[model samples]
Target chain A: LAKTTQPISMDSYEGQEVNITCSHNNIATNDYITWYQQFPSQGPRFIIQGYKTKVTNEVASLFIPADRKSSTLSLPRVSLSDTAVYYCLVGDPYNNNDMRFGAGTRLTVKP
Target chain B: SAVISQKPSRDICQRGTSLTIQCQVDSQVTMMFWYRQQPGQSLTLIATANQGSEATYESGFVIDKFPISRPNLTFSTLTVSNMSPEDSSIYLCSVEGTDYGYTFGSGTRLTVV
Candidate 1:
């Protein structure tokens, strides 16, 4: 399992874009970068996932560099409802059932 | 996406007593995982529940203290034995599918007093 590091908290205004970066220096070649959003008292929701380059979805986008040591999750036009704790995980989703979660980045979208 | 329904969404248990949390998935899954999350902290994997077999627990967790059972592919249970105030946390069950990323139950909030 690869350990990830992310900001403890971030503040963003509504309608602005927010980017949370995660560092996984020990990421493996077979590992995939996944981001999950967790609201208060709810399970974490899958936001986006990518192996490399950029992958965009209806909710967010994931950008991974060639080195695979780090990845960034970009949320466009944020709103108050989007405020939540975002986790970045890097691992082989198939083989590694033991997923380790970091402290996560708490994004606060304000008005 | 798979829907996981966990029982006893929230419970207040007395110290030294035990509580069993149940997780039922809508579809069959190869693996089911139990996790514990302390308030304002990250998730900690408790064990992996395998169908018709014993569960593999993590380093800090043990079967005697946190027993697990997976009678079938779609159902599992985790029992917190000898509960204490330190055991107060949100217990979550999760499953992964080929198409779906990962689905987690709403979680069981246990408070020991």
Candidate 2:
């Protein structure tokens, strides 16, 4: 399992783009970068995932560098409802049993 | 995608008592997982529920304290034995999808007083 480091908290205004970066210096070649969003009292929701370069979804986008050491989750036009904890995980998809989540970065979308 | 549901969305139990949280998925899944989230803290993986076999627990968690049962692929239960104030937390059940993403239940909030 690879350990990830991210900011404890971040604040952004509504309608602005928010980017949360995660550092996983020990990421493995077989590992893929995934991001999850968790709201209060709800389970973590899958936002976006990518192995390398950029992957975009309706909800968010994931950008992974060639080195695979770090990835960034970009949420465009944030809203108050987007305020939640964001977790970045790196692991092999085949071995789902060992996936783990870190402390996560709490993003507060201010009005 | 799988739809997961948990019973007893919230419960208040006295110390030394036990509460069983149930998880049911709409479709059969290969792996089911249990997790705990303490207040103001991140999620912690408790164990992996295996069908027709014993569950694999994580470090700091024991089968005696958090017993998990998986009779089939779509259903599982986690029992918190002899609860204490320290046992108060949100217990969530999850299953990994074919896409390698996790789908989780709403979570059962247990309050031990």
Tens-digit per-residue lDDT, B1-113, candidate 1: 89999998999999999999999999999889999999999889999888987898889999999999899889999999999999999999999955646888999999999
lDDT of 2 by residue, B16-76 (tens): 9999999999999878999999987889999988798999999999999999989998999
Fnat: each model in turn: 0.65, 0.73
- Which residue pairs in candidate 1 have backbone atoms (N, alpha carbon, C) closer than 3 angstroms, thus clashing? none
List model 2 lDDT by residue over A1-111, tens digit each: 549999999999999999999999998878888888999999898888889999998998889988989999999999999999999988887765356789999999999
Candidate 1 local distance difference test against the native: 0.91
Off by over 4 Å in 2: B98-100
Task: Write one digit per residue (lDDT tens) for candidate 1, span A45-64.
Answer: 88888899999989888999
> Each candidate's lDDT (Cα)?
0.91, 0.90
